[model samples]
Target: AASLLGAPIGHDLCIISLSDLMTPWERIEKRIRAAAIGDFVTAVYNPKSEGRYWQLYRLKELFLEERSPGTPVGYVRQAGREEQVVNLTTLAEFDPEQVDMFTVILIGNSQSYEAGGKFITPRGYYGEIKMKTDVGIGQDIMIRSFRTIEKELKDKEMPLDKKWALLHAIHTTADFDMENILRIDDHAVASLYEKFNRGEVRTIITDVTMAASGIRKGALQRMGIEVKCYLQDERTIQLATEKGITRTQAGIRLAVQEHPGALYAFGNAPTALIELCDLIRKGKATPAGIIAAPVGFVHVQESKHMVKPFVSIPKLIIEGRKGGSNLAATLVNAILCYNDAEQLKPGRDV
Candidate 1:
């Protein structure tokens, strides 16, 4: 059966006969229940015959209790013989009349599927190679850059999401040192992806106009997310002068007040990052995430360290004072790239 079906029975499986000739009906029922509960792919032999008709119906009913209606079920009659016949169907659509003593019924696990006239039960390595091949042909440079980064960081212990984000950063900056210096909270970037995909994030607040300008406008427009920088606003100037604070800091305060829960990306001013952390700590603002990468020596490290304790919010921080507007924009674009890749349909141009 395995040879005929291209190794569908390679995983956990059991074989049960429903004839009840040598085995009692109660024992066969118990075995079927055990297979179903154990999540084992089952093969039924001698399912039905002229004298044994009701047992196959009972077996299907019991399996349906534990399996999904759409679970793939394949039956092969007279396997490896001249009169061999094979048919693929789901558990809900299986006809007991088509199965007889010479038929072998193979029931798949929950992860199985029927495609291209074949039934397949994936064993965890299903689409790994296909995805790589697709990405290789679709985006050659991106795939090559990712592979190079993966090779370089082979020994580094980091989460997969962080590795992907850092790969884009290194690809943009061409600086390998950024890999070690970047600090990402666990699942931080993934949280951003979730918010972005769900359309929950509607606005992006940037400290500088340059950072805002760097974000992909078309992508943001398609996603219905607005990029805003209040540095040029008249209100920001008045507030900064009155409070004796930097214009970027005042802009952040005002932006947070106006666009609560918006993502904040700061690339030029350490004061802006510091102000955002202070505002969040004071309960004056609640942002979706923070991408703080202020480049300089003065208070840069301090400002980044201030945001480190914000464990609840997703953050992508360049640990030292080694970031600039370009890196910040690159990080934002990296997120957009991920979103675009997710939206890419098979056989469609990326």
Candidate 2:
């Protein structure tokens, strides 16, 4: 396919004809490579016919080498005619087999994005969309901060759930190092949201009261999820005194005995996480999920390593000794608001 740049309406768009009927295939390929290297939004005409089936596939492979899989691609068939058909898909999902001689394909440039079911190429101007008046200044500032973090993200091609949680983690700590430390299981956020929405998992057990209190009460109330900490429980104190174990470790035992299926979160006590791991191994507790981010220099690294073998459980872990109560709570917030992931919207209950 010959790629062409057709910039109309003062925007740069390259139009290339892939028809080899009147042009040499090698010359057409050279032009396509140049357009790809130039990062031009491209349009292809006569992409495929019965004799030209493999050409479109090669064109797609060439573009992929220079483009993000998230790049938008749209196609129209029999344009300006009653039989016209339009389709929008990503470059990763673009199907060459669906094209014919009558179809015209348009691929988005680096700055182009898909919005509202249409491919949008910016005309070099942007305006800030104001939030509602009732959202308050703090929420507005937080939203702005999220946008800034998003723009500076090193890898913006991650899954929506991971990206959503990453924004919150970075916003809370203002630590760019979090981009490298945060590790989330595939579909963990979405699967937990489904469970929470169905009221399957309703309790969260934190290693300390700080983590329990850090989570927003409004969101917990709205979701009907309880944040529980057994650190101050009389039974935990007694268990620690009798067994000569750390109070936090004893607290996990009491919490697990009471709420075996609760979502277990750790932010300040590695000993507590290790104790839970012991319980899980012994079949004494089966948690809904785990957030292993207990921050410390002691057994912090080991505690995280302890939980990784249970691949069946959904988990979110901060790999190093760089986690805290705020980080743990923000991740919980990410799960509570995951329905807004597609829009990158947060603080629904704020």
Candidate 3:
């Protein structure tokens, strides 16, 4: 029903049965919240019945929490049957009085729209891009930017995941030089993604709060990955004084002591990266992977050079003085979406 109604078949979709017969209401509501927050095309089965009319209203309320009132939604009654009936409406205008258990509701994602009475969700199959004034303006702009990056990218021959990561970096900075500077070890993204999925690595230690803040919180929460920054921790302040070290260095030490196997990402602090390297050499830390991209003239180049010897650990490096919190966060985003590399469908969860 969703595909027929013009939901983007190429993008992520969430199918939900709102019947609380065997499933607890809370659990079903949890799924609804996830779908809404993730901005996925949602197809709802068993939306209403004699005893379930209120549930559908609650679901609408949940969707409205994330989506605009004008978001497109469609429904089909007895779809594909002799008495098939389909209707298109905005989310605010979708009337539950007309729906029942036999009806299937299709609520478009943030990018969905109503055109020529057909419900539509656009998920970036970009030969040309058009901006629509709708609930998904931000995503539309991002999709346009991604297509622009694709057209302007210098190296189209790189591996899919690496190229995907580069796209993210270029998107973040608008710096085409990322093609020349960004480096990914063989299968680095895949390895880290596996560890994340297997629950072997659940934490990411960033050198600063800015780096931590830039990471996509929606994906991190869904994957149950914890991002921790110790720079602002009082314990880190105390430790810095005790060790006579820079706050960033102390933060890394404290982070390593707590999560020795977590992925460590460096953005603003070269000293922190240097300190992590020192810890790894001295058997104090065993990070799952390292993102070595600290932007500075002071020890930044040296810090990246220091991390190169640890061939056993996976890595993504941005060479030279071009790195930031956004860059590190976007690289993390790339690995998390590595499974989507071949498909070129980034940002399933915004």
Candidate 4:
């Protein structure tokens, strides 16, 4: 079965039912020792339950005699279901109580490590090449960013129109460094807008400070939206313009140096954003896809784990590790399913 499924030779299968309800402990122990001597990759079934728990520990000891502690161990709890939790840990950390009748454990032949806190079991590419797996990392970062925004926006749900207009005005004003509003609130609004426009947000809100400059009024006017502001301050407007240039210049630098995959910018940071945009438009970067967070950016191309071919606007404005992880997992699942279905279909030959 392993060979037919493209698994390598010398791959022997060992199954041990950890449940003591039917199978005696003596029989289970004997099978464990035999499989260890046989050097077979073992799959455990019925590893834990309310009544039985020590089997998992005993099996670990049995395998430890023959196998190195660094062996790759995979845990699939409730596999192929909505409540599925799959992870690869080391044999040393393997716990029997973590699994029940619904769990399946696969332990490999001594090659696993914790990289950046993730358990990685390499197949053939251990020393071959550096993996283009930064997408996964970037996705992780994006998820963190999204959670921040989601928490901030949790309470304000209805009347999205007010949220939308205010958010837009706030973002525009903030970019211009407009004053009269608290700096912290401006930062929040700035961050919120940046996050929202990245294609993730459906709505947002802003605070209005009248007698502040007509910046919001002017912006609303240009956008054909009506809004009234009290207490317009010319002094604040003057200072905002001076500070805005400095902010824009800083953004341009960070976007260029910090973001590896950013090919373009679409907002007020014109000199920098426009340059990047032009490069992207001209096909120089040939970006696999675009990911926008509140202030984070990354580019990705399709690879084994990520099977989606590069497309325009793969995901917009959604940020953080959770979003990226979900996207990557979805893409991989879709590709694998499609490939399997294609193989099973009738041949084209007449």
Quote the lDDT for 304 in model 4: 15
Residue 191 alpha-carbon offset, candidate 4, angstroms: 41
Q: Write the per-residue lDDT of candidate 4 for residues 207-290, one digit (tens) a residue.
A: 122111212332223233222221133433444466663333333333334333422212122233333344455554432222
Q: Which digits, one per residue and each the tens of the lDDT, describe model 1 over residues 1-350?
A: 65466435556778888886887889989999999877778988988867889998888888777775556788999998999998888787899988778999998765455556767654443335333233445454455455445445533445556766787678768888887788888887777877887998888888999988888776686677889999999999999999999999999989988997999998899999999998998998899999989999999999999988888988999988799887787777666556443221111222
lDDT of 3 by residue, 87-147 (tens): 8887878888888889999887655656667886665544455543343656656755665
Global lDDT of model 2: 0.82
lDDT (10s digit) by residue, model 2, range 1-350 = 11221222335667788876788889989988888878788889888877778888899988887775667788888877788888888887999988889988998766555556767654442244444334565665665577567656788578988888898999999998888999999999888888998999999999999999889888899899999998899998999999999999999999888899989989999999999999999999998899999998999999999999989899999998989898888899888889876644467666
Q: Give TM per candidate.
A: 0.58, 0.71, 0.63, 0.31
Highest TM-score, which number? 2
- lDDT computed for candidate 3: 0.84
Q: Provide the global lDDT of candidate 1 against the true structure.
A: 0.77
Rank order (by TM-score, best first): 2, 3, 1, 4
Which is superior by TM-score, 1 or 2?
Answer: 2
List the global CA lDDT of all models.
0.77, 0.82, 0.84, 0.39
Q: Between the candidate structures 1 and 2, which one is better when assessed by lDDT? A: 2
Q: Kindly report the root-mean-square deviation of model 2 from the true structure over all alpha carbons.
A: 5.6
C-alpha positional error of residue 237 in candidate 4 after TM-score superposition, expressed in Å: 79
Task: Name the regions of candidate 1 deviating beyond 4 angstroms.
Answer: 1-139, 154-157, 339-350
Model 3 Cα displacement at 182 (Å)? 0.4
